[model samples]
Target: MTIPKRMWWQNSSVYQIYPASFKDSNGDGVGDIPGIISELDYIQSIGVDVIWICPMYDSPQVDMGYDVRDYEDVYRPYGTVQDMEVLIEQTHARGMKIILDLVVNHTSDQHKWFLESRSSKNNPKRDWYIWRPARYVDGQRKPPNNWIGNFGGSCWEWDEHTQEYYLHLFCPEQPDLNWENSATRQAIYDSAMEFWLQRGVDGFRVDTVNMYSKGDMVDAPITDPKSEWQFAGFQYCNGPRMHEFLSEMNQVLQKYDAMTVGECPHTPDMAKVLKYVSRKEKQLNMVFQFDVVDIGQGPYKFQTTPFNWGLPQFKHAIETTQNLIRGNDGWTTVFLENHDQSRSVSRFTSDAPQHRVAGGKLLSLMMSALSGTMFIYQGQELGMVNFPMEWSMDEYKDVDSSNYYKMVADRSHNDPKEMHVAKTSLQHLARDHARVPMSWSDAPNAGFSAAKPWMRALDDAAICNAKQQQSDKSSVLSFWKRMLQLRKQYSDLFVFGEFDLLDKSNLEVFTFTKTWQNKKALVVLNFTAEEQKLVYPTEVRSQKSELLVSTLDTPASDKLAAYEGRIFMLES
Candidate 1:
């Protein structure tokens, strides 16, 4: 078998930071570039090679910072462009690369291009956005189609000035750009991409990349009969011309030798994903697929009740994704937590006070042993969990969470029982759970800010803060550092080795092996709350093994403790 050539990204691990909740330098209750600069040494200590910062562009904060009003400038609260320059320089000086969030799939309605497009029907920039006349049904004007926005409500927003409706996959304030227009594509390349490359910025984490080339604007098939609108992901996600546009964009990235990881949602077909990352396609270096994270979700993320799922299903998702690039040149990303998803510990394992540390270490061991680039989100190293269930709806600040709650209330005609059910689901699944302020120390506001934070800090910050963990050798944060270091030390065995699944029928334990030539490593993980028997494969039972790391205080002989994970090096 011909092993794929190793690249810098393949062997590197990434640390993702959501700037708003990371730290606050100016005490405005918001994290800024200078705040990130102060923690550079701390991030380096975790042994990450790249830092991926979420969008901080000038915006109205309609969808956090996803709505970009100015591609060339930084948000005033996030410091100036010069501060960004200093961040880039400092990160590189420390031998770590920095990648910015690229959100060109849409622009804020307040952006110059969108403003010009909405000025008049005959404006030159009118073709820059997707606009269509309203459909009159039964003597009443309606949106162009029966499509639902990702957040909620109609996807088409009526514009009073142009007398036409424009499409917004997310919110009305953020309008989708017309990728069919060559001029629009060129402008994004020059302004959003090349501008940063010229400033020594590494690359980007492209947002909703596959949604750039949309199909025909026909009404989506009604999957939920009770709903008025339907999800139009089939019409826009992984559209027909996605590769063509991505290949064109790759031409620009190639000039600077920059790396890219596209965010492709609603994509279940691994073959289609390969086209985006395969070296033969010349598109992107890797892509973030949503299969593993979407396990318990229903048709929509904010369901009244979560779908039933277990470790077996979760393992299948991971194995399927990992095997996608086994013999191919394509690559994938391994991540359990991000800005859009809830905390992995609370969702995947028992998050009780007794099991939280072991649960966090289990996840680190599993992900670090997998094949591909691993990404660690902020606060994950400290085993941060979801917000307390007692938090009221007013405490949840994400736009999606609030919109979903309102939709449920409207549909149920203000039923108090229905409202309570929605709140329960939001407590478990809302994106706001991940947006809580990082616990820096036990100080007021968790040391996130001198003033009140934009969002509440975790209730357990006193125990989960970084300052407390950094001093404790047995803390979850310390385990993460050791696991990352092990991955680097055994790069050939962990990063370039072929993965093989073992005991696929086991429901409580996740067992796998990574083999590179004569070197073999066995990984065992217990996913339940109770102790389980450790049944090793017969072939390796007699072989001498060296213990690399274990979540438990002592290595298990016959039974594994709750959430225990162990990695052993076997002599072939």
Candidate 2:
């Protein structure tokens, strides 16, 4: 375990805003930069030091904003370049930092580079993207390999005009860049520097950072015989030159006074992660791993199985990651919710009306007290739950969810029971679960827009929203504020402390401690909705404990109420 040196990001709290769902300002039923600007004060009031807005670059919205058509310009619907400039300035003025999404791994087919690459074989940009000749099999043309896209279906998309297949790890419209070419790498790196460095934007949250390079395009040995996607996924992720490419990008990032956190998924190994985020390696400052986040995934990573999980499994994942990164010069980000996953309150905690707030607080305290930077997704502070499971299939907007539904229906031969189970999985794990509009008020469109919202507002917006929570002292929002305040007050103990897992085999509660120098903080969390006692070891039971913070107003003797979490400063 490597201890991380003091850095700006280590002390900062990040709030991720899915731009389209955050707020729609122009009455176009879409959120924009101006809309984000309007909520700057509210974001600042929430105590997050940094705002990580999802990709807002010029795009056709094929994969939302991840499929970038123009790297230097902003999406017209969201705003113009000048609007982004103003937003940055406004964010700085309010003493908060803002980071844009860096999506260089792929570009929309409509992008000039892709268009030129596919225009003709001899075009100067032909080598800018991955393209291969079709392999004839049994007198029929087929893609060169069996690789599958992360979204669904084959990874290869045939281009009739060019008579070749261009690779896309995601949607067909989003083509992966050919990073093996020096010129292609140089162009992407230069564009990133010109756009953010000149505008004085804080940094970036790199999208699909690990898949820039690819291995030999051959059929992967099937590990999970039942899941072809899983077999192909092994070949498409964490390519051979990932480290070389990231190190080169870091060389450029190091010249600027900024930070970067790569969105590295499917990386279950610590060494693979440390290679990129280690300060000694000069790559990224941190990365978002999916060990705990992908807990209930089915055969393949994207396939969502039933929500069957336990405290022991959850504790092991978190503890193993913490132990691996501890003092190893590698840094990781702690989060329970993000744009690609369901809300924590809904998926990980008891969202029952009576226990919702406490459950949210328990999750929040567990996240904040972990030995890494804390990322809070929008509406999470308000204890937002998932969209009601009753919403028909038509109400969902995400391409991923729709694709998964079709795949499952086909596999199950349209069996009503199987389709119902698939729909339930979508309700619990779909990316859209976190894509609902930000609930700002009880007013129409949840005060997100005077016009109709692009998506329907949560039915319970009136009960759970920023307006209601900001006014209530015991709201999840308020508790989050206190957590951040304490984090700041005890930076040495919380941000730079050594983490040690306690009662590793405990099945009822998750317990751990963070110690720095002579100070120690013990955190105990009841994983279930029923009261449980923390079985403290003899050494800790003998020591004096001072309550620092808790999810419950009053402790019930030695028993912890459902979803209750407590932090006690130990007197050694």
Best by lDDT: 1
Off by over 4 Å in 1: 1-4, 304-307, 538-544
For model 2, how does the per-residue alpha-carbon lDDT over 1-572 read when each residue is reduced to its tens digit?
Answer: 34445788888999999989998988998999899999999999989999998988899998898999989988898999898889889999998998888999899999999999999999999999999999898999888877768887778899999899999989999999999999999999888555676788788888888888788878766665555443565566688988889888887877776889888876776888888888888889998888788887776544555558777888887876666567677777888889998888888887779888998899888888887888899999999988888999887899998888888788889999989888888888888878889999999888888888888888888888899899899999999999889888988888778888888777778899999888999999998888897667665887789899888777776899999999999999
Q: Local error of candidate 1 at 374, Å?
A: 0.9
Q: Which window of 10 residues has the lowest lDDT sum in candidate 2?
A: 222-231
The TM-score that candidate 1 achieves is 0.98
Q: Report the error of model 2 at residue 341, Å.
A: 0.7
**lDDT for residue 44 in candidate 1, whole number 0-100:** 96
> Which stretches in model 2 have alpha-carbon errors above 4 Å?
1-5, 223-230, 301-305
What number of backbone clashes does candidate 1 have, counting pairs of residues 3 or more apart or in separate chains? 0
Per-residue CA lDDT of model 1 for 250-310, tens digit only, reads 9999898888999988888889999899988999999998889888887787673653687
What number of clashing residue pairs does each candidate have, in the order they appear?
0, 8
TM-score for all models, in order of appearance: 0.98, 0.97
lDDT at position 314, candidate 1? 88
Q: Give the root-mean-square deviation of each candidate in angstroms.
A: 1.3, 1.7
